[model samples]
Target chain A: MDIVVKKIVREVKRGNQDAFAELVDLYKDKVFHIAYRMLGNAHEAQDVSQEAFLRAYTNIESYDENRKFSTWIFRIATNLSIDRIRRKKPDFHLEDQVSGTDNLDYHSQFAADIDLPEDQVVKLEMQQWIQDEIMALPPKYRSAIILKYLEDLSLKEISEVMNLPVATVKTRIHRGREALRKRLGQA
Target chain B: MACTRDKQQVINQYLDEEMTLLESKQFEEHLHSCPDCEKHVRELKKTTAIIQSASHFEAPKDFTAGVMDRLPKQSKTKRWQQWIRRHPIVLTAAVFFLVFVTSLSAGFGAEEEIVVRGDGHFIINESERTVVIPEGSAIQGDLFIRNGDVEVNGEVAGDITVVNGRHLQASSAQISGDIEEINQTFEWLWFEMKTLWNDAVPFLTPASEEE
Candidate 1:
């Protein structure tokens, strides 16, 4: 996967749309997932994802191949999501009633369809619960948690993505998890 | 025993898989004996799992095709046009050429005559050649003349040299240098309207015909 991405990146640097298309295909899912998780809306996530890819394509020359392409794309998506959230100035109180329904339904339906072991179901439910908890977090904590877990990025990668220091990323992740645990207990 | 603050650092390194095997084994041993640290690890793991599951999202169908449709088609002609528009030298040269042509055309049709930068020392040798220097004039350099007559009722700071001119005239004209004259007739007329008019349109109306 790394080699393929590197080749596609080279082609993209040369201004080849087909190469860029391959890259887009390669990471579009992950990018959309990150944006959706960060922004909590499908339409906004899609828009943010599209904008991220467009920005990446236009500025492909600026990308450093030595770094992970995934981290770079994730950074773009995450920043765009943050900007969109800031612009919306969404009232947090109403977010639960409005945004939680679709996700809750999706999780419930998936749970019903997937007849897994007891432990797996518990894990899946816990995962869904954590996601909802993350959404309820402040934007800063939410980004920290998403980058640390969903993207499975290192502290260094999270720092690069968030434009923060490694120590800051670690602190955010630590505090974010603590907050999630507290919220989970209340739930 | 209260879990030491160092336990948090240990947990962070453990989560990041940065600890060596011996360190991991030591931490695992510590967790086995400490329920508080064990609970912390479990909570952290659960939180990580939840975030991972919640973040799963799919891209919209035809996302790539949509993006490709919006991108401007790159072609050689388009690139060339954009390059020319952005190149500073090309743009500057184009603007200079336009200004030069416009100024040249405008100068040919101008009516009011004005001595832009020359000195007052001048001569006219042609049959109807007339020169007009306005009043309160100051010439800092020398002026020369050929086969045309001149009328300087203003001032000349340098030498007035004439050669084979018809008429050499100066009215209250100051010449700082020598006034060298060749084959030409000299005249001093006070308020010479014919000479003034003839000088105004020297090429059109010759002085001899006007006189």
Candidate 2:
């Protein structure tokens, strides 16, 4: 561990709430991004992120120093998001709600304005298409892809984050990309 | 092997830059001869690029502030106090020192002739009395008393000897020896009293000069 991280761990062990708060500040954005990408909703992402941090704080003692703190936090966020997805009862009408809401209109407008730069517009469209394909994947495969590519984590790191073996992580990432390519009609 | 699914997976790893140099060269050799696998590699690279370039979600503003505000305040003093309290050696030493100080301030009244023997044992030479040990001596043997109170000082190497005594003061004493009492009249009240006293002392004492 870095000296600062060691100090944070010591402080947290000693019940120093400020040190914990600093830790939360340092990793909150990255955690939120991972959760948001996995869950696809700002509110649910925020909830999962908060829950992850809270769980991390409560179980801070169990954190292994040999692993990166970011990996551990992301693991918590990913697990929580996966749990939410699994527990969510299928509701067909929810799709209508998502597309019908003013929030979708606002997001679409935001997406449009974001693509205003002419040279990047095509790239942005392609990214949007790929993101759609990723979202269409099963939650397990989606998580594997996001961690491997979007987060650019190593197979070992992804394994640690997902609580799986390195081989499993590798297989998931490969299979996820294959599935995504097929879904995007590139296969 | 030119376009097997396993070869395609390896090629994907190669395109993702996750393969070793030797593996990359091998994958490229396969890709060179197989146009289908080569196309697959290009598509996978484009897909990786697309996902990598996607905008990362930003957390709401005030996220940190909100979490911190919801979190309980960190009290350095409280933490320090808890740290001190949790250390068994420190806690024991502290309680020992405290009982010593209180015993000294209360004064070993003339009613008890509490004679700690040279062999590191306490000898209460009187009957039907109380003995209080102040915190700085080394006694080596079990206390032996026929009918008197006994108190321990510092570290004793042997068992306590109590005979029809009213009270045994064992605070501030690390007895490596067991305690032996021969009568029901020997009350073990002072240790509890001292513990209660130590716990309550901070509240009652006037505020000393702040550290």
Candidate 3:
């Protein structure tokens, strides 16, 4: 898959429009998911995801193939989501989980691997509840927590995406986790 | 036992596995004695687990196509036309200012003439291309200057018109009638619009750049 992606990236660098389209198709879900989790709104997530692809297309010459393409695209999506959230200043309430309903029924392979049906349901509900708590967090803390968990990025990788020091990323994650503990524990 | 703030920070670091071996051992011993810190660590671990289990969202089926459609096309002429269409006010102001400045500069090198009418005592300095109306001099009829400049140092009871010429008014020069330059209606309108635009340019520029 890496080899195929690398080949497509090379073709894209050579100005093949179809290759770039293929690249967008490959990362669109990941980008959209990151944006959705960051923004807590599906429409805004879709907009940010589309914009991230457009930005990647325009700035393709600046992409360094030595690094993973996913990380680069994720970084662009992260920046756009952060900027959008900051600019709009949306009032996030814990009760408003409209975006949470979009994918609650769609479980991952890991969730399916669970032996018991009732346990899977509980796990899914817990996941949904955690997502609501994450949405209620401040943008910076929300970004750090989402990237650390959803993307499963290392602190160093998150630092690069956020353009912050690893120490700062760790601090954000710690604070974000503490906030979630307080909020979710109450519920 | 209750946990100190610094110890609580160490507990968080330990939970994240960021502590060194020695630090971890010390923090473990402290946590063993402090039930509050132990409970906090357990809750943090659960929080981390729940966050990691959060679901991924799927993009709409047409997302890629939509983005491709919105991408900047390679045609320069289309982009230029789009830009011109978007900023109608800016384009109009630019054209008006250009024409205004061009007309003013075109009239610069023309021959000088001064027409002083009845009871209008004036001094003509042909070398300077200037006609000075004296302090006490008051003109009854119209004073028309063509291809020259007028320095109104005294009162004019009648209309003063300058054609392809510049007008300078002093403190004593009060014209009872209208003073007209760039005589056509559209030309006056364009000139006024250009002046208004020039005054407004500084305020308009930063706002446009921000967008």
TM-score of chain B of each: 0.33, 0.32, 0.34
Give the number of the best model, judged by TM-score: 2
Say which candidate scores most in DockQ: 2
Higher-TM-score candidate of 1 and 3: 3
Greater-DockQ candidate between 2 and 3: 2
lDDT at residue B64 of model 2 (Cα atoms): 77
lDDT of 3 by residue, A1-187 (tens): 8889889888767655556889998989989999999887889999999999999988988998888888899899999998998899557443444454753332331244546699788877776667678878998999898888888888888888888999999899888888888876445
Superposed Cα deviation of residue A126, candidate 1 (Å): 6.5
DockQ of prediction 2? 0.37
lDDT of 1 by residue, B1-211 (tens): 1188889888978987889999999999999999988888887776566556563667989988877776658898755755764587998899999996665444332232322234543333233555555566766765555444456667776666544443345667766666654542222222134447777988877644433
For B1-211, candidate 3 gives per-residue lDDT tens digits of 1267887678667877877999888877877888988878777777777777777779999998999898766566655655666679889999999997786655443553454444667888888877788888877666877666788988887777775667899887888777877655466557567657857785766663343
Give candidate 1 regions above 4 Å deviation: A1-7, A92-128, A185-187, B1-4, B20-33, B73-211
Off by over 4 Å in 3: A1-3, A92-128, B20-26, B74-211
Q: Score the docking of each candidate (DockQ).
A: 0.32, 0.37, 0.36
Worst ten in a row by lDDT for model 3 chain B: B107-116
Candidate 1 on A1-187: residue-level lDDT in tens?
Answer: 8888888898667556656788888889999888888876788888889999999988899999988898899988888898888899645542243454653433333334646899988877765656567678888988888877777877888899888989888888878877887666334
Provide the lDDT at A121 for model 2: 82
Sorting all predicted structures by lDDT, with the top scorer first, yields 3, 1, 2
Clashes of 2: 3
